[model samples]
Target chain A: MKKKLIVKKNFLMSLFAVILGLIAGAILMFVTGSNPIEGFYYLFRGGLMNIERIGNSLATATPLIFAGLSVAFAFKTGLFNIGGAGQMLIGGLCATAVGLTFDWPKPILLTVIIIAAMIGGALWGALPGLLKARFNVHEVVATIMMNWIAYWTVFYLVPLYLKGPFLETESQRIPMAASLKVSWLTSLFSGSYINLGIFLAIIFVAITAFILERTTLGYELKAVGYNRDAAEAAGIGVNRNIVLSMAVAGALAGLGGATFYVGFASNMQIGVLPSQGFDGIAVALLGANSPWGVFAAALFFGLLHTGKGFMNAMTAIPPEIADTIIATIIYFAATSVLIERNWDKLNKFRLALRLRKSKQESLEDDSGGEQ
Target chain B: MVDLIYQLFPYAIAFTVPLLITSLGGLYSERSGVINIGLEGLMLMGMFVGALIISRTESIYPGTAIWIGLLAAMLFGAVFALLHAFACVTLNANQVISGIAINMIAAAVTVYLARLISGSGNIQIIRGLSRQTIPILSDIPILGRLLFTQTYATTWFVLLILVVATFLLYKTRFGLRLRACGEHPHAADSAGVNVYRMRYMAVIISGACAGLGGATFIVTISGEFNGTAAGLGFLALAALIFGQWKPWGILGAAFFFGFASTVANVSQVVPMLAQIPGIYLKTFPYVVTLAALVLSSKYSLAPKAIGEPYDKGKR
Candidate 1:
């Protein structure tokens, strides 16, 4: 019952944060001399107006789902994996290399590509974990350093190894044999960008949920997260768990990169770190670090991202308003403690009013009986 | 080698000043128990505001517009940091998350406003600071040629601020009280130091200094606002850590980074540096910082009570 209450409270808190974010967006619109209601109407309509648009939204959300899951998973282990951008870059690089190298059967080629991506990302992530575990180096700093290293590595490698025929900044396009997109799914979405990545995302979400709720490894990781000294006293191999957790987190993000580079986008672009990596942090926070919650939040953000372009085309509002709203939501989410305090106060006030009403009725009954 | 060093000296100093000031800003905040990762966003805000103000007033004010714009940026940055201070100090929110929020908000809002003012989402200034050599100081020796010649006015200003800040932090009662709050807030509170106030002041000062750093970048190197600081703020944060949170250490670290970056940027043209891969030079500072972190882990000088919300009722 207590667990159920906590879950319900989290849901309500998330809802409250979303509403506050929208209101902040509205205020910004108003301040900018645009009609907020009209802008919002067009925004939602653009996202859901047609089946193709819905498919596009889902496609946009595919990488976000994986990125969010990666962040949420690390968060469960009390680790902040801000190196998602670097991991994703490495993962994408690995996937691109695999896709461009071989001309094997479609199924076999894609399998190799995905595994390569995961391994690359895992190796990238484990170094920081190793540093943190052995040297007591802070993961935040290590991850950031890793990010720059990965950036420079990609910058140097892509031009030399993966460059396209003419363009110097991006990789050669992935052939259909290695891509995550299939004809049937494309036809089903009516020429939309949706691909097999969505199914993969769902499967991983379920897997993450199961592992976190029903597995011993998850329990041990959580215990260490809750209190390191206590977990050590309980004989948990804290160092091993930390490294394993980071490797797993890195794998998830690497999978996100695979979906992004081979599934959504046709080519890996150099000199750019994917913004989805940072957006994943917002998604995890707003989702309360839950797997399914991350899924839902990713979809919501995906819708906003997809619709913003249409909104910009139709109205005077710039596309950045969507970003502003998302940022505001994150800010509100960070300050949820203050919201919780107010919520409790409001509940207590309501309870006191109900008690006063009940007492008045009893007093009136007693007076009538005496008469 | 001497010729190359001479050629790069001014550029290195130009890059280092912004980082030095920004890292010192971080030092103040961390010393007061706040972990501010929002320096990047704060710098962006400063760059945008500085560009906007200078672009508007440069024609009218001629010589004084850049200074005015920098001052405005500092003011606005201080005002912006109040949100972080309120969230962390008053509401006791998670400092790291709140800092992230500050970053996101600043990035989005600044771009939104920039787009409104300029359709291209970039602000350009008509003029920027020029390098001026010191009159008497430039004729001394090799040291004078490298240090005193071709220096920006803002460089001298920032160096002066650094010295004053160092003195203020080490030699004053207020600084002692502020450092005490970061180390032991409860004890400081018992001794009549208002922890909340000190933290607020520290965070605000950080914002102002970061703003100045960003504006300095605009006037000295960039000469335009392009909605990003190219990760300089994060580099400064790394320098803060690599320096073990000391003023002199930060200066050295910042200079090391600046020199490395300048070399990387000019590697293709310089015959000696071209032999080495540009990628190595580009990644050197970050790699070295990580190594430093590993080496210094045993003697980490991070503030004792950093990133923790002070709760008087807990202990």
Candidate 2:
């Protein structure tokens, strides 16, 4: 690959956002009367210093990766897939239900559960897409309502059918046969919770990249996103593409649900909508809505999350404030488009200044030659 | 049946007042061509600030502190919402994304600040608004028994706001200008309206009202702030949409959701609703909202340029 000092446009912009986010986080630490350098040092050390921490970071990043892709993919097709949490919930619920109920062989059951999760998530996702496409209803409201629906569904169903031995809040743990952890993988990682989900996440990353960059479906979807009326006038079925994009987005988040409830940790808990779903929005924005960009952004966010507890333990800053730092980072990341726009304007101003200097220099040369 | 009706109605009104106020707040922002999904965060800001004020002043003013809390909540809510306003309105950020950031930040910041102030994450409001009977209205038979008896002073205050909000939205030149900005901002500009200023003012006002709603929530329901409005902001947004972006329509929607929420909260307390599962009751409003969005949205008429950032150069 040819190397450039600034790299690509979206990646460069995202890098700027990341740097800005870190500086903002540091400022927050400073404001709270903590040493920013010391805080950041331990934060990185917590997520990367040990093999277990590395494995744990990758494990934590797994769901975020899928959720980011879900949001990013739909974004490419002009759909804001804010329902990642609901899709993840429904997907996790279906996967857990399958994992606990089935007695099938390992590969078969895992495959079945994964497929069920994708389907369940797809249904939840496509509903809002369909409404937006057909009726012009806003996706944000529909998806938010769907989140509550999924929340209540899991809250209701877990206790009624999947209750564990002691806890009324969580579903029964998955049996070893249906679990995502292979003995070799666990040993290779030295007893970490990192499972098959990480590999699957990498594979899906490549698959999404191919689907987005190399397919006619991707072209059609992008055409719709760029201008729906123009796409429709050009003979593209904008409505179909919208729903299809959301389904694909939902499928990715569904896989993440499998990663979370079955792979990283077993059993679904009631009452809490997965914060990863909202975090996906930040990830997607920071990544500039690209699949590979989302992968990197998710890993970065994973480091922040994994390192946070350690950052808290070593400093006067409490965990709640640490969480506030993460949120502040997200707040800045979301406004990165502002930074990008300003950067573009600044570039234009520089180009104009350079042209004016060149014009003045040529005029001076002409005058000197005449003299 | 009358007794059951009597019991649920007062509870429903208590619930309705906040939802109504919040939805009205949302209406101002949405009507000015900005989507204020920050209502949730704004509400949380109100709850946090209001509860903080009430907690800190519990000893100083003891009896009148809750009213002071209400004022502090509105001011603080508007202040925090200024971040969102600056992002979406001035910087031309994606309104939904900005709103989501505001919501996430509000939850975290409130908890963090509460922890810093009280040395714990939880901020408790020792005193809250007590239910009061309107002396003359309480003796007026059906109306008094149904609407005036055993209600918080907040119910009347919110009602007064609703009437004022409706009058201002329909009868004032400012409302017309705000509505014009939402529908056709370029046209409004050509008509010599300051679209940007109107939107900013509407959003700030929206934040203030939502904060007041949050104050009412803690005052009427929780009696304490633990860093969430429990999705009441989203429910307010839902009411804004369900009411078809009109004041009367939003009131009806808020009333419906309020009753549904009351049912969910009071299911165990009420003998008839106790037999139903808690999950179903909790899920009812969401399901109904989704169905309503699906079935009625085709006929819905939103402000023409609602979610887009206005560019002076663009046609």
Candidate 3:
């Protein structure tokens, strides 16, 4: 019971936010004259009703898990990495380029592709880090700018080098050797788009959690996040950590990009920076910046997106309205800082009252025994 | 050359107004110790509201829809910004996260509402504002022809806003206190300025300016709100950085972007410009903005205490 309480306390705030988000979504549904309970019923059912849907949700969550980790990892180092979008794009681009050009054995090719994606993303992330560390250039503005640069780079590269026979807006379809999907896995999932990325995401989640919880590096990074000046005074290399943190973030986002372009999608599309990049921010926040929590949050978001179509089809709610509800929930979840502060205050207050009560009871017992 | 000037100058002014006003909007917020990265989202909100009002009420009030829409946009912007103000100032939420949330809300709300009302994502104005030349100014020489001819009344409104904003920023008591709060809120608090109130007011004013700018875009230039300001808000943010948060410098930067946008738009009409690929032309301004940011960020004089939520109890 005690252990359960402690576990609940650790995740209680995030769970509260989730419940509040659901209530907000329900309110929107009710206001729109639909039954909120029914709306949610179908929504969850669509994502989990069958083996195929479950497989699809997990597949959809694969990239989001990486994206969430990317954002969360940076948050631990006192950095707001809004450039995840650009990093993801560049990462995807590199992966696509390698996949399209090279012919090698599956193991070597996949390894090379993943490494290339990580490098591309790391380079993109490192620029903003260097700028912020060296030049005092605000990372937010620099990353926003970098997003556009990546956008145009993909825009130019797609049509110029890897255009398909019919479409001008996307690259050529990645061949079977370059793809992440295998015949046996597809068959097991009954023709779902499930791939190797899900397993990779799970392994990385465990790795990231281990790094953050059990390692000296993560401790130093967290210290930097808590107080940069204090950490600097304590002899931590502040600038190096900032850069290293961002590079790791970028690499994580790059892995997400690879999962997306190579595993889930057959070809790379132009003219869009992936929405998953931005969703990563929501995922990180919702997960309370925990690696395992990010996995769960990402899975939830994947369920929403995967089930969104069913909700639209079954109810009077339009797709745009559904999206509005989700974004509203995100808007509320983004206020987790305030919620966290309040929760901390409440805990302290409760602890203080309990201590006073125990002290008075002990004094009373002593008096009765003496009498 | 004459043809180029004639073609490009008017469009430049039209495009420049939003960038100028939005950056000025950013200036107010940042100068008052609040970092508002949601200017893009706020502008989108104003644009969609203004467009919706005009489109729906064109039949009811054809003569006054545009002006009414502008005011409506401003009102909507203030209300929306109140949410941001509440989050950042009162709740002490992470400013960047809140700003991003505000942006997501705006993007989501506008598209959903537009589709809900218009049965489509895009909202088109029935009649766009026409150009008006100043009566006495039209009779003047080459200067008048270059400046006054074939321009919307919002052009003059933009100039008026620029002057008033400059005056209010530099020459007023409130302005001094606002600047003081941004520089050192504790000092301002010691001097009897309410730091929270000042920051809140500054954010609201930022909203109003962004609203007017967004209305100008819908009323004069685009004649439609397509659920996006086409990233003009981010450009305005770039201008704010490039301008070093000065009014005149912001105007100059706004004009530079405005000219670039005009070049992008008029390339279809101009013979020399038509040779370039459409994609290249589209990407030019964004690339230039990035370059400008990289250069300008090196010398930026941003407010000292900006992005820090002022806590009065902290020494």
Candidate 4:
């Protein structure tokens, strides 16, 4: 019971730290003659003013949700998936290929492209996962290297592979058949080109949460993350969990890639590949690696990004400041030790007070008995 | 045949020097078990600051002194990385996430700070190091022209650092302690070695080395900083891995990468290769780096506790 209270205190301290960092940043801005209140007002109004703006936000949020989920999922099985960017890239390119090359019924074509993207992403993700599981290789090194490989591989291969009308230095336009339509929910988004992908993203998060929280597989995975030797002793297949978690994580990021092709851009070039995968890491960290937390974090990042255009339209403040804010939050949030140490102090104070009260009660009882 | 080898030699040596120096810098941090993902950021900051100082001073000797100015940038990079270390080391945060955060923050901060200073993202018109030819070897015909004809002060400095770093990591008592802290911090702590201090030292060394590499780039090649350390951090990272996290091994690997890079750029300029129809040849260096990374995947090993933070009580 005391332990639970300590955990709560640590959390509160970390929260306060983030608040302090924000205040410091705001003070800096104020001293520089940039009104903090006005800057934030511009930020909010520009980000969530109306249905169109909100739709733009969902469009931004969809990929991040997948990316955050990817990182969070991998975190559960004791692996770090730095290759999310690469996996997403592979997924993007694969989806683009399927979108351009295949001819099918509209719904079927869209499904095929999404599946292809997932497979591509999964394959990319599996390589590093397998290497680590089998060879005891460091995933951080492998995944980071893989990111560059994906970057240059796409750089070299995309031009050769892409075909059709949209195929210049940029990618080909995705077929209408391969596009995910949001015709049903146009009222919420006001036809801003944001589709049902936001719902899909939410559903994906739910699925991941459910799998991690309820299933035997989830229990086994969590066990491994906590302690590999203990998990192995408990008869859990540690290697399998590591590989499976990475594969599923990659698929989530792949879906993020599909969302871009089918729901938003309909065309992607090399540089245009969104930093969603990288941003997802920040999102997952900010959310403390919980799936639901990741969903909320994704929304926050989405809001920040969508508001960029709005912020630029309204104020001289660079939209990149929002990213700086996010980085600061992560920095403050990551320093949980300081928080834990403070909480420990608070717990010790409470314990001492409790002990003194008990002693006084005993003394009172002794006096009454003597009388 | 003679002409081809002669043309290749200068380009290879020139390019190899930077990669060797930078990757060797990467070795210090990684060997001590802090994955210095901020190497690229430090290099970028170093390049920018070093360029500005050298340009304002207008003397290569003072330009050489601009490396001291890079200590501020290195400290900046270290503090930036302290964010990562705090996350990964203190909070047991995921290493890759912390790293990516550092990369993002570094990129944004460097650009933002650069804009504040120069009114532009790109800093130009910086004074650079003039390549000095060896006094006695200038007349030694082909070999002299290839090996000793012209290079930055950093080229020789890197060679010397490599020898010293190689010794420091392997021969020195400090090296043994640093390696012990990385591999088994609890043991190191029990032995009264300051584990945290060692890790911080490793990371700071990485920042400084990365700074030197960045400083060298501005002073030698670019004469201006356009964030020319563009993705070179990853290349240095690749070299580190390809070298299997060993100092001498990484130097050789970096040299290979350097050779490939120079060949790619120079090959494009060659009249014969220029006649080719595709851009594939231009992308050869990145392709090689990719291949090197993938092929070395099986062999590269990290310290036992490379990314894990030391928690004495938990132990």
When sorted by TM-score, best at the front, the candidate numbers are: 1, 2, 3, 4
**Candidate 3's error at B249, in angstroms?**
1.7
Q: Lowest summed-lDDT stretch of 10 residues in model 2 chain A? A: A1-10
Model 3, global lDDT:
0.84
Per-residue alpha-carbon lDDT of candidate 3 for residues A235-317, written as tens digits (9 for 90 to 100): 99999998899899999999899999999998999978787887788888878788998999899888887776677678765
Please give the lDDT score for candidate 4.
0.73
lDDT of 3 by residue, B1-315 (tens): 787787688888888988888889989999998898889888999999899899988889998989999999988887888888888888777788888877777887788667656666899998988899888997788778878888888888878988998898899999999999889999999999999999999999988888888988999888998877767787888788777778898898888877876786777688887776655655565566556656766556788889989998997
> Candidate 2, which segments miss by more than 4 Å at Cα?
A1-7, A353-371, B118-120
Better of 1 and 3 by TM-score: 1
Candidate 3, residue B60: the lDDT equals 95
lDDT of 2 by residue, A69-131 (tens): 999999998888888998999999999999999999999999999899999999989888888
Predicted candidate 4, C-alpha RMSD: 3.9
User: Root-mean-square deviation of each candidate, in angstroms?
Assistant: 2.2, 2.4, 2.7, 3.9
Which pairs clash (backbone N, Cα, C closer than 3 Å) in model 2?
none
- Kindly provide the TM-score of model 2 when superposed on the true structure, using C-alpha atoms: 0.95
Error of 2 at A314 (Å): 2.1
Candidate maximizing DockQ = 1
Candidate 1 lDDT, A235-309, residue by residue in tens: 999999999888988888898999999999989887787878877888898888999999999999989988888
Instruction: Please tell me what DockQ candidate 2 reaches.
Output: 0.65
Prediction 1 global C-alpha lDDT: 0.89
Instruction: Identify the leading candidate in terms of TM-score.
Output: 1
User: lDDT of each model, Cα atoms only?
Assistant: 0.89, 0.85, 0.84, 0.73
